[model samples]
Target: MLRSPKDPLSFDSREKIALFIDGANLYGTAKTLGFDIDYRRLLEEFKSRGYLLRAYYYTALVEDQEYSSIRPLIDWLDYNGYKVVTKPVKEFVDQTGRRKVKGNMDIELAVDAMEAVEHVDHFVLFSGDGDFRSLVEAIQRRGRKVSVVSTLTTQPPMIADDLRRQADHFIELAHLESRIGRDPGERAARAAERQDRFARDADPEDI
Candidate 1:
Protein backbone atom coordinates (compact mmCIF):
# COMPACT_ATOMS: atom_id res chain seq x y z
CA MET A 1 0.00 0.00 0.00
CA LEU A 2 1.24 3.49 -0.83
CA ARG A 3 0.61 6.52 1.29
CA SER A 4 -0.58 9.56 -0.54
CA PRO A 5 0.82 13.04 0.01
CA LYS A 6 -2.54 14.16 1.32
CA ASP A 7 -2.87 11.30 3.83
CA PRO A 8 -3.70 12.41 7.35
CA LEU A 9 -0.72 12.62 9.68
CA SER A 10 -2.49 10.60 12.39
CA PHE A 11 -2.58 7.52 10.18
CA ASP A 12 1.16 7.08 10.47
CA SER A 13 2.85 4.59 12.84
CA ARG A 14 5.24 7.09 14.34
CA GLU A 15 5.53 7.43 18.11
CA LYS A 16 2.90 9.62 19.76
CA ILE A 17 4.33 12.98 20.78
CA ALA A 18 3.07 16.00 22.70
CA LEU A 19 4.46 19.52 22.76
CA PHE A 20 4.37 21.73 25.90
CA ILE A 21 5.47 25.24 25.11
CA ASP A 22 6.09 27.71 27.93
CA GLY A 23 5.07 30.80 25.98
CA ALA A 24 7.09 33.41 27.85
CA ASN A 25 10.18 31.26 28.04
CA LEU A 26 10.06 30.40 24.36
CA TYR A 27 9.58 34.05 23.44
CA GLY A 28 12.61 35.04 25.48
CA THR A 29 14.74 32.24 24.13
CA ALA A 30 13.89 33.14 20.56
CA LYS A 31 14.42 36.84 21.27
CA THR A 32 17.89 36.14 22.60
CA LEU A 33 18.57 34.11 19.48
CA GLY A 34 17.31 36.95 17.26
CA PHE A 35 14.33 35.30 15.54
CA ASP A 36 10.58 34.91 15.81
CA ILE A 37 8.81 31.57 15.98
CA ASP A 38 6.82 30.58 12.93
CA TYR A 39 4.37 28.61 15.06
CA ARG A 40 2.76 27.05 11.96
CA ARG A 41 6.10 25.74 10.79
CA LEU A 42 6.99 24.58 14.29
CA LEU A 43 3.88 22.43 14.48
CA GLU A 44 4.41 21.15 10.95
CA GLU A 45 8.00 20.17 11.68
CA PHE A 46 6.97 18.19 14.74
CA LYS A 47 3.98 16.62 13.06
CA SER A 48 6.28 15.40 10.29
CA ARG A 49 8.42 13.65 12.92
CA GLY A 50 5.66 11.83 14.78
CA TYR A 51 1.98 11.28 15.45
CA LEU A 52 1.29 14.56 17.21
CA LEU A 53 -1.11 13.92 20.06
CA ARG A 54 -1.37 17.49 21.27
CA ALA A 55 0.37 20.85 21.21
CA TYR A 56 -0.06 22.88 24.40
CA TYR A 57 0.88 26.52 24.81
CA TYR A 58 0.76 28.23 28.23
CA THR A 59 0.76 31.96 28.94
CA ALA A 60 -0.51 34.58 31.36
CA LEU A 61 -2.73 37.54 30.56
CA VAL A 62 -3.35 40.79 32.37
CA GLU A 63 -7.10 40.80 32.66
CA ASP A 64 -7.28 44.36 33.96
CA GLN A 65 -5.89 45.73 30.74
CA GLU A 66 -8.41 46.69 28.05
CA TYR A 67 -6.23 44.95 25.49
CA SER A 68 -3.46 42.45 26.12
CA SER A 69 -0.26 42.47 24.13
CA ILE A 70 -0.32 38.76 23.51
CA ARG A 71 -4.04 38.39 22.85
CA PRO A 72 -3.69 38.07 19.09
CA LEU A 73 -1.07 35.35 19.35
CA ILE A 74 -3.18 33.45 21.84
CA ASP A 75 -6.23 33.71 19.63
CA TRP A 76 -4.27 32.56 16.61
CA LEU A 77 -2.86 29.57 18.46
CA ASP A 78 -6.27 28.58 19.81
CA TYR A 79 -7.71 28.48 16.29
CA ASN A 80 -4.68 26.80 14.77
CA GLY A 81 -4.52 23.38 16.44
CA TYR A 82 -3.04 24.43 19.78
CA LYS A 83 -4.41 23.85 23.26
CA VAL A 84 -3.87 27.25 24.81
CA VAL A 85 -3.84 27.56 28.59
CA THR A 86 -3.96 30.96 30.26
CA LYS A 87 -4.45 32.59 33.66
CA PRO A 88 -4.70 36.14 34.88
CA VAL A 89 -1.55 37.90 35.99
CA LYS A 90 -1.33 38.40 39.77
CA GLU A 91 -0.30 41.87 40.79
CA PHE A 92 1.04 42.67 44.26
CA VAL A 93 3.37 45.02 46.06
CA ASP A 94 6.64 43.64 47.38
CA GLN A 95 8.32 44.43 50.71
CA THR A 96 9.93 47.48 49.14
CA GLY A 97 6.49 48.83 48.11
CA ARG A 98 7.31 48.19 44.49
CA ARG A 99 4.45 46.65 42.52
CA LYS A 100 5.06 43.49 40.55
CA VAL A 101 3.10 41.00 38.54
CA LYS A 102 3.43 37.24 38.91
CA GLY A 103 2.10 34.81 36.39
CA ASN A 104 4.14 31.63 36.46
CA MET A 105 2.38 28.83 34.61
CA ASP A 106 4.60 26.11 36.03
CA ILE A 107 1.89 24.45 38.08
CA GLU A 108 -0.58 24.47 35.20
CA LEU A 109 2.04 23.08 32.88
CA ALA A 110 3.15 20.37 35.30
CA VAL A 111 -0.38 19.22 36.07
CA ASP A 112 -1.20 19.02 32.37
CA ALA A 113 1.97 17.08 31.59
CA MET A 114 1.29 14.56 34.33
CA GLU A 115 -2.27 14.05 33.17
CA ALA A 116 -1.04 13.54 29.60
CA VAL A 117 1.75 11.10 30.46
CA GLU A 118 -0.43 8.06 29.89
CA HIS A 119 -1.53 9.15 26.45
CA VAL A 120 1.80 10.24 25.07
CA ASP A 121 4.95 8.29 24.26
CA HIS A 122 7.19 11.32 23.98
CA PHE A 123 7.06 14.75 25.60
CA VAL A 124 8.69 17.80 24.10
CA LEU A 125 9.19 20.67 26.55
CA PHE A 126 10.10 24.15 25.31
CA SER A 127 11.39 26.07 28.32
CA GLY A 128 14.53 26.62 30.35
CA ASP A 129 12.91 26.87 33.76
CA GLY A 130 14.90 24.79 36.26
CA ASP A 131 11.74 24.04 38.24
CA PHE A 132 10.70 21.64 35.52
CA ARG A 133 13.64 19.37 36.26
CA SER A 134 11.52 17.38 38.68
CA LEU A 135 8.65 17.26 36.20
CA VAL A 136 10.94 15.87 33.55
CA GLU A 137 12.27 13.29 35.93
CA ALA A 138 8.75 12.32 36.90
CA ILE A 139 7.72 11.98 33.28
CA GLN A 140 10.78 9.84 32.52
CA ARG A 141 9.93 7.54 35.43
CA ARG A 142 6.55 7.00 33.81
CA GLY A 143 8.46 5.47 30.85
CA ARG A 144 8.03 8.30 28.35
CA LYS A 145 10.95 9.90 26.56
CA VAL A 146 11.37 13.60 27.36
CA SER A 147 13.09 16.13 25.12
CA VAL A 148 13.92 19.62 26.42
CA VAL A 149 14.31 22.38 23.87
CA SER A 150 16.40 25.40 24.89
CA THR A 151 19.64 27.05 23.86
CA LEU A 152 23.19 26.93 25.21
CA THR A 153 24.51 29.06 22.36
CA THR A 154 23.92 32.40 24.08
CA GLN A 155 26.54 34.15 26.24
CA PRO A 156 24.52 33.10 29.26
CA PRO A 157 22.66 29.97 28.15
CA MET A 158 18.88 30.14 28.15
CA ILE A 159 18.50 26.59 29.49
CA ALA A 160 19.24 25.57 33.04
CA ASP A 161 21.96 22.97 33.52
CA ASP A 162 19.86 20.82 35.86
CA LEU A 163 16.85 20.72 33.56
CA ARG A 164 19.02 20.06 30.54
CA ARG A 165 20.74 17.22 32.33
CA GLN A 166 17.46 15.71 33.49
CA ALA A 167 15.84 15.41 30.10
CA ASP A 168 16.22 12.14 28.18
CA HIS A 169 17.28 14.21 25.20
CA PHE A 170 18.29 17.87 24.90
CA ILE A 171 17.44 19.73 21.75
CA GLU A 172 19.11 23.09 21.22
CA LEU A 173 16.61 25.69 20.00
CA ALA A 174 19.37 27.44 18.11
CA HIS A 175 19.66 24.44 15.81
CA LEU A 176 15.98 24.57 14.90
CA GLU A 177 15.94 28.28 14.01
CA SER A 178 15.86 27.66 10.30
CA ARG A 179 13.12 25.05 10.58
CA ILE A 180 10.84 26.86 13.05
CA GLY A 181 11.81 30.54 13.12
CA ARG A 182 9.73 33.03 11.22
CA ASP A 183 11.20 34.59 8.09
CA PRO A 184 12.46 38.17 8.36
CA GLY A 185 10.84 39.02 5.04
CA GLU A 186 7.43 37.83 6.26
CA ARG A 187 7.33 40.41 9.07
CA ALA A 188 6.17 43.19 6.80
CA ALA A 189 3.70 40.99 4.99
CA ARG A 190 2.30 39.62 8.21
CA ALA A 191 1.93 43.10 9.67
CA ALA A 192 0.00 44.16 6.60
CA GLU A 193 -2.11 41.01 6.61
CA ARG A 194 -3.56 41.58 10.07
CA GLN A 195 -3.77 44.64 12.25
CA ASP A 196 -4.50 42.41 15.23
CA ARG A 197 -1.25 40.44 14.89
CA PHE A 198 0.69 40.69 18.16
CA ALA A 199 4.14 42.19 18.33
CA ARG A 200 6.79 40.49 20.48
CA ASP A 201 8.14 42.14 23.64
CA ALA A 202 11.66 43.53 23.81
CA ASP A 203 12.02 42.52 27.46
CA PRO A 204 13.18 39.17 28.79
CA GLU A 205 10.84 36.25 29.35
CA ASP A 206 8.21 36.79 32.06
CA ILE A 207 4.93 35.30 33.21
Candidate 2:
Protein backbone atom coordinates (compact mmCIF):
# COMPACT_ATOMS: atom_id res chain seq x y z
CA MET A 1 0.00 0.00 0.00
CA LEU A 2 1.15 3.52 -0.73
CA ARG A 3 1.75 5.87 2.17
CA SER A 4 0.42 9.37 2.58
CA PRO A 5 2.30 12.24 0.91
CA LYS A 6 3.28 13.40 4.42
CA ASP A 7 5.32 10.22 4.82
CA PRO A 8 9.04 10.53 4.21
CA LEU A 9 9.05 7.78 1.58
CA SER A 10 5.92 8.64 -0.30
CA PHE A 11 6.02 9.64 -3.96
CA ASP A 12 3.35 11.69 -5.70
CA SER A 13 2.07 10.25 -8.94
CA ARG A 14 1.60 13.65 -10.55
CA GLU A 15 5.17 14.85 -10.06
CA LYS A 16 7.74 14.40 -12.79
CA ILE A 17 10.60 12.04 -11.85
CA ALA A 18 14.06 11.21 -13.10
CA LEU A 19 16.34 8.37 -12.11
CA PHE A 20 20.08 8.76 -11.59
CA ILE A 21 21.77 5.42 -11.27
CA ASP A 22 25.40 5.03 -10.22
CA GLY A 23 26.08 1.88 -12.21
CA ALA A 24 28.79 0.32 -10.06
CA ASN A 25 27.34 1.40 -6.74
CA LEU A 26 23.87 0.12 -7.64
CA TYR A 27 25.34 -3.18 -8.85
CA GLY A 28 27.15 -3.66 -5.55
CA THR A 29 24.07 -2.74 -3.51
CA ALA A 30 21.81 -5.07 -5.47
CA LYS A 31 24.36 -7.89 -5.28
CA THR A 32 24.46 -7.49 -1.51
CA LEU A 33 20.67 -7.59 -1.49
CA GLY A 34 20.79 -10.98 -3.25
CA PHE A 35 18.97 -10.20 -6.52
CA ASP A 36 19.51 -9.15 -10.07
CA ILE A 37 17.69 -6.06 -11.27
CA ASP A 38 15.49 -6.60 -14.28
CA TYR A 39 16.19 -3.17 -15.72
CA ARG A 40 13.20 -3.32 -18.10
CA ARG A 41 11.01 -4.06 -15.12
CA LEU A 42 12.68 -1.29 -13.12
CA LEU A 43 11.81 1.25 -15.83
CA GLU A 44 8.20 0.10 -15.89
CA GLU A 45 7.92 0.07 -12.12
CA PHE A 46 9.07 3.68 -11.83
CA LYS A 47 7.02 4.75 -14.83
CA SER A 48 4.03 3.40 -12.94
CA ARG A 49 4.93 5.46 -9.87
CA GLY A 50 5.04 8.80 -11.65
CA TYR A 51 5.90 10.56 -14.89
CA LEU A 52 9.33 9.12 -15.60
CA LEU A 53 11.19 11.87 -17.43
CA ARG A 54 14.41 10.03 -17.94
CA ALA A 55 16.76 7.38 -16.51
CA TYR A 56 20.51 8.02 -16.57
CA TYR A 57 22.97 5.18 -16.10
CA TYR A 58 26.66 5.87 -15.48
CA THR A 59 29.59 3.48 -15.84
CA ALA A 60 33.23 3.22 -16.87
CA LEU A 61 34.43 0.98 -19.66
CA VAL A 62 37.75 -0.80 -19.86
CA GLU A 63 38.53 0.11 -23.45
CA ASP A 64 41.70 -1.93 -23.47
CA GLN A 65 39.78 -5.12 -23.05
CA GLU A 66 38.57 -6.83 -26.17
CA TYR A 67 35.54 -7.95 -24.22
CA SER A 68 34.05 -6.12 -21.29
CA SER A 69 31.48 -7.93 -19.20
CA ILE A 70 29.19 -4.91 -18.91
CA ARG A 71 29.19 -4.00 -22.59
CA PRO A 72 26.10 -6.03 -23.40
CA LEU A 73 24.13 -4.45 -20.58
CA ILE A 74 25.25 -1.01 -21.70
CA ASP A 75 24.20 -1.72 -25.25
CA TRP A 76 20.85 -3.02 -24.09
CA LEU A 77 20.23 0.09 -22.02
CA ASP A 78 21.27 2.42 -24.82
CA TYR A 79 18.67 0.87 -27.11
CA ASN A 80 15.99 0.69 -24.41
CA GLY A 81 15.28 4.32 -23.41
CA TYR A 82 18.14 4.95 -20.96
CA LYS A 83 20.58 7.79 -21.29
CA VAL A 84 23.86 5.94 -20.80
CA VAL A 85 26.97 7.88 -19.78
CA THR A 86 30.40 6.29 -19.84
CA LYS A 87 34.13 6.93 -19.92
CA PRO A 88 37.27 4.85 -20.18
CA VAL A 89 38.66 3.26 -17.05
CA LYS A 90 42.00 4.54 -15.75
CA GLU A 91 44.58 1.94 -14.73
CA PHE A 92 47.30 2.88 -12.26
CA VAL A 93 49.80 1.48 -9.77
CA ASP A 94 49.50 2.56 -6.14
CA GLN A 95 52.28 3.52 -3.70
CA THR A 96 52.20 -0.03 -2.33
CA GLY A 97 52.90 -1.51 -5.79
CA ARG A 98 49.30 -2.65 -6.17
CA ARG A 99 47.28 -2.14 -9.35
CA LYS A 100 44.20 0.05 -9.14
CA VAL A 101 41.33 1.11 -11.37
CA LYS A 102 39.85 4.59 -11.12
CA GLY A 103 36.35 5.24 -12.42
CA ASN A 104 34.13 7.62 -10.52
CA MET A 105 31.08 9.17 -12.22
CA ASP A 106 29.96 11.41 -9.36
CA ILE A 107 30.76 14.71 -11.08
CA GLU A 108 28.98 13.66 -14.24
CA LEU A 109 25.89 12.58 -12.38
CA ALA A 110 25.83 15.73 -10.25
CA VAL A 111 26.07 17.97 -13.28
CA ASP A 112 23.25 16.13 -14.99
CA ALA A 113 21.06 16.33 -11.90
CA MET A 114 21.64 20.04 -11.54
CA GLU A 115 20.76 20.61 -15.16
CA ALA A 116 17.69 18.38 -14.85
CA VAL A 117 16.33 20.16 -11.77
CA GLU A 118 14.56 22.73 -13.92
CA HIS A 119 12.35 20.03 -15.41
CA VAL A 120 12.10 17.27 -12.85
CA ASP A 121 10.02 17.47 -9.71
CA HIS A 122 11.71 14.56 -8.00
CA PHE A 123 15.05 12.83 -8.31
CA VAL A 124 15.74 9.21 -7.48
CA LEU A 125 19.43 8.58 -6.82
CA PHE A 126 20.56 4.97 -6.80
CA SER A 127 23.67 5.09 -4.67
CA GLY A 128 24.80 4.91 -1.05
CA ASP A 129 27.87 7.13 -1.35
CA GLY A 130 28.08 9.73 1.40
CA ASP A 131 29.81 12.02 -1.08
CA PHE A 132 26.38 12.71 -2.57
CA ARG A 133 25.04 14.36 0.59
CA SER A 134 26.00 17.80 -0.60
CA LEU A 135 24.53 17.07 -4.03
CA VAL A 136 21.23 15.99 -2.50
CA GLU A 137 21.11 19.13 -0.39
CA ALA A 138 21.75 21.29 -3.43
CA ILE A 139 18.94 19.62 -5.32
CA GLN A 140 16.56 20.06 -2.39
CA ARG A 141 17.42 23.74 -2.26
CA ARG A 142 16.18 23.96 -5.84
CA GLY A 143 12.79 22.65 -4.60
CA ARG A 144 13.00 19.14 -5.98
CA LYS A 145 12.32 16.13 -3.82
CA VAL A 146 15.22 13.70 -3.65
CA SER A 147 14.98 10.02 -2.80
CA VAL A 148 18.03 8.00 -1.86
CA VAL A 149 17.73 4.34 -2.80
CA SER A 150 19.95 1.95 -0.89
CA THR A 151 19.74 -0.69 1.83
CA LEU A 152 19.98 -0.47 5.63
CA THR A 153 19.37 -4.13 6.47
CA THR A 154 22.86 -5.35 5.59
CA GLN A 155 25.47 -6.12 8.24
CA PRO A 156 27.25 -2.78 7.94
CA PRO A 157 24.45 -1.08 6.02
CA MET A 158 24.84 0.17 2.45
CA ILE A 159 23.51 3.72 2.93
CA ALA A 160 25.55 6.61 4.25
CA ASP A 161 23.83 8.17 7.24
CA ASP A 162 24.55 11.73 6.18
CA LEU A 163 23.23 11.09 2.69
CA ARG A 164 20.10 9.43 4.04
CA ARG A 165 19.57 12.34 6.41
CA GLN A 166 19.81 14.81 3.56
CA ALA A 167 17.26 13.05 1.42
CA ASP A 168 13.52 13.87 1.40
CA HIS A 169 12.83 10.15 1.03
CA PHE A 170 14.67 6.91 1.64
CA ILE A 171 13.62 4.10 -0.70
CA GLU A 172 14.89 0.78 0.56
CA LEU A 173 16.30 -1.16 -2.40
CA ALA A 174 15.68 -4.48 -0.65
CA HIS A 175 11.98 -3.75 -0.36
CA LEU A 176 11.78 -3.10 -4.10
CA GLU A 177 13.26 -6.50 -4.95
CA SER A 178 9.96 -8.10 -5.83
CA ARG A 179 9.10 -5.28 -8.20
CA ILE A 180 12.47 -4.82 -9.91
CA GLY A 181 14.43 -8.00 -9.36
CA ARG A 182 14.95 -10.69 -12.00
CA ASP A 183 15.27 -14.34 -11.16
CA PRO A 184 18.90 -15.49 -10.90
CA GLY A 185 17.97 -18.23 -13.34
CA GLU A 186 17.54 -15.54 -15.99
CA ARG A 187 21.31 -15.20 -16.30
CA ALA A 188 21.73 -18.91 -16.97
CA ALA A 189 19.06 -18.70 -19.65
CA ARG A 190 20.14 -15.36 -21.13
CA ALA A 191 22.27 -16.69 -23.95
CA ALA A 192 19.50 -18.93 -25.25
CA GLU A 193 16.91 -16.24 -24.68
CA ARG A 194 19.01 -13.71 -26.57
CA GLN A 195 19.47 -16.01 -29.55
CA ASP A 196 15.79 -16.84 -29.74
CA ARG A 197 14.57 -13.31 -29.18
CA PHE A 198 17.02 -11.91 -31.72
CA ALA A 199 15.96 -14.33 -34.37
CA ARG A 200 12.33 -13.58 -33.72
CA ASP A 201 12.65 -9.81 -33.59
CA ALA A 202 15.10 -9.42 -36.45
CA ASP A 203 13.58 -8.60 -39.79
CA PRO A 204 14.92 -9.70 -43.17
CA GLU A 205 14.24 -6.24 -44.62
CA ASP A 206 16.37 -4.68 -41.86
CA ILE A 207 19.06 -7.32 -42.35
* lDDT winner: 2
lDDT of 2 by residue, 1-207 (tens): 225323324668999999999999999999998899999999998898899999999998875888888999999999998999998987889999998888799999999999999999999999999999999999999988999999888989999999988998888888888778998788879878988889889996865
Per-residue accuracy of model 1 over 89-132 as CA lDDT, tens digit each? 86889999998888799999999999999999989999999999
Task: Write down the TM-score of every candidate.
Answer: 0.84, 0.86
Question: What TM-score should be assigned to candidate 2?
Answer: 0.86
Worst 10 residues of 1 by lDDT: 1-10
**Each prediction's Cα RMSD?**
8.6, 6.2
**Candidate 2 lDDT score at position 192:** 85
